[model samples]
Target: MSADPGSPSAAQVELDGVERVFHLGDSDVHALRDLHLRIGAGEYVAVMGPSGSGKSTLLNILGLLDRPNGGRYRLEGRDVTTLSLEEQAQVRSRRIGFVFQSFHLVPRLTAAENIGLPMMLAGIAPRERAERVARALKDYGLEDRARHKPDELSGGQRQRVAIARATIMAPALILADEPTGNLDRSTGVEVVRLLEALNARGVTLIVVTHDPQLGARARRRLLMEDGAIKHDTMAAETV
Candidate 1:
């Protein structure tokens, strides 16, 4: 377990006066309202809220997939809000990893290829990419399934591959949305434990889950309501 919300530093993520708005028919919808929060490096945090609480919107903004209508987003002391679309995509590809509830593996690609996809996109050297992919496959216990396609693997195995793929780029941050949503209880726990292992190695992890039991496992739990943070509690670190 980590500390109880240890003091955030320049290395941490800062969201200052973030706002997101969308137009719905003839009206305006405020998805996020002047949200300000900081998440330190190596922290395993969970965000919880109902369906319409702007959880996905916030996650998208954090992941750099969507831009905020207003506010500055600084990642590792660099202002990224003003970057061009291509630059933002590059930053996201190089700095962030994403794991969604639905394993987004391409049906045509093998497990090994899927794990190496990010590195391939980043134009990493073939030998280095191969090395990382091998390690990732072995680390996630997918070596035996390296040649198998997603359709052939079990749910747990597919999720494992997804996790491996997410971290193979050695991303600074991992954003997981309902990672365990499609798995059984035992398998879900296993998946989460694998994620925690990565966090233990210093990658910032933020998980969005609707399950209280799952959220409670994190050191910091953020409760959201109506597109705003209702409460954020730092629990005693679990030994």
Candidate 2:
């Protein structure tokens, strides 16, 4: 559970009549169909569905990795749907963090280095990068594994590093797509707790998962079918 039941903050995400279509061999695949959704600041949301249902497409649009073919998307009150590619990239770098199923850590980089990658890309000074990375390492309990590469770390440690890296930019929104897909049940539990801890600190968390048990833990659950949300409900009694 993330956002409080009576949150006063404005919406962090807003979509109006959103549509996404992919053209494949003269066939139009409607990935998202007139979708409209809003997530308030600090909300924790889980999107769930079968493989072809469009949960990934919706997450992509929210993360600014994919643009919608039609309709408006406002992120933090700005019209992101109309942003140029460069502008969108800038926004993404500054305000969004992404966690993927594969962990997405650079194979060659040490855990500390990977955690600091975003700041490095943004041209942060070395001292600042070092300070932030060190703090993140401690925050994620990765100090002992700082020098380890992704291959050297266990599944849970790697995911912790990925999460550290994702949040090092101080992103307002964290988009996790199947974050625990590659991990065992206990490790997945650890990762989910880490995500929820960040959410407790007021960062908006949106996770895409097929696991029903995991989805039930969120304050809000959305079920997608046929490129649209079939169900959207807040927890009556949080699990």
Candidate 3:
């Protein structure tokens, strides 16, 4: 289903009978099986499951980083399952933001340059890129560290820079995978609060985490097992 154009939310995602299979040496492993899901715009959702339960696979599919072997995916009301590689890349660049546990920032680039990388890759003009990067750095409380490279920053600082870069594109959806896995308890809390703030501002946020404390903070939760959703908090709530 599509989001209302006049609504404050910006994106909607739907998956119908999606399946993903990987070939091992002589056997096939199903990573996702007939998984059907819908995420409305501006929702805060946590995906929780044990290792090999398909949490990361699900995130990859939603972020357009991987294609499903069966079924269809619709994002913002358009069937994106069949888009060409170039088309998918275009859509991913403009519409999706991702935060990883390792804080995937360029080791050689300074914070400002890293934050501006997406715009640069998209061929945005230098002046506009600089302006937006500056705003993001300030917004993420990394203004003072803009000139610092990743190695020079602390774990928390590096994560802040990563978050800034992720959001610089103003993406309709933000996907975070173990976003706080490398930080201390306090720092992790700080990082999650930052993500939550973005969600509060109407960005769709989906997080994959093993931390029950962190998962509990989401408005809705999905429990995955054997490549399918075993429980959905929203569905239970409605019933």
CA lDDT scores, all candidates in order: 0.86, 0.88, 0.88
Cα misplacement distance, residue 57 of candidate 3 (Å): 0.4
RMSD of 3: 4.1
By lDDT, the better pick of 1 and 2 is 2
- The ten-residue window of minimal lDDT in model 3 covers 1-10
Per-residue lDDT for 1-239 in model 1, tens only?
21111321223588999999999999999999999989988888999999999899999998899999999888887889999999999988877889999999999999999988888999999998888788778778888999999999999999998888877766788899999999999999999998887787787889999988889999999998887999999989743
| Residue-level lDDT tens digits of model 2 in 1-239 | 22111222323999999999999998999999999898999999999999999999998999899999999999999999889999999889878989999999999999999988988999999998898888888878888999999999999999999898888877788999999999999999989998988787788999999999889999999999989999999987657
Candidate 3, residue 178: CA error in Å? 0.3
Tens digits of per-residue lDDT, candidate 3, 1-239, equal 01112223457999999999999999999999999999998889999999999999999999999999999999999899999999999999888989999998999999999988989999999998888787777778788898999999999999888888888878789899999999999999999998888887788999999999999889899999989999998533310
State in Å the error of residue 127, model 2: 0.2
**Each candidate's TM vs. the true structure?**
0.94, 0.95, 0.94
Question: What value of lDDT does candidate 1 attain over all alpha carbons?
Answer: 0.86
Backbone clashes for every candidate come to 0, 0, 0
Task: Flag clash pairs in model 2.
Answer: none
What local lDDT does model 3 show for residue 186?
100
Give the runs in model 1 whose Cα sits over 4 Å from its true position.
1-11
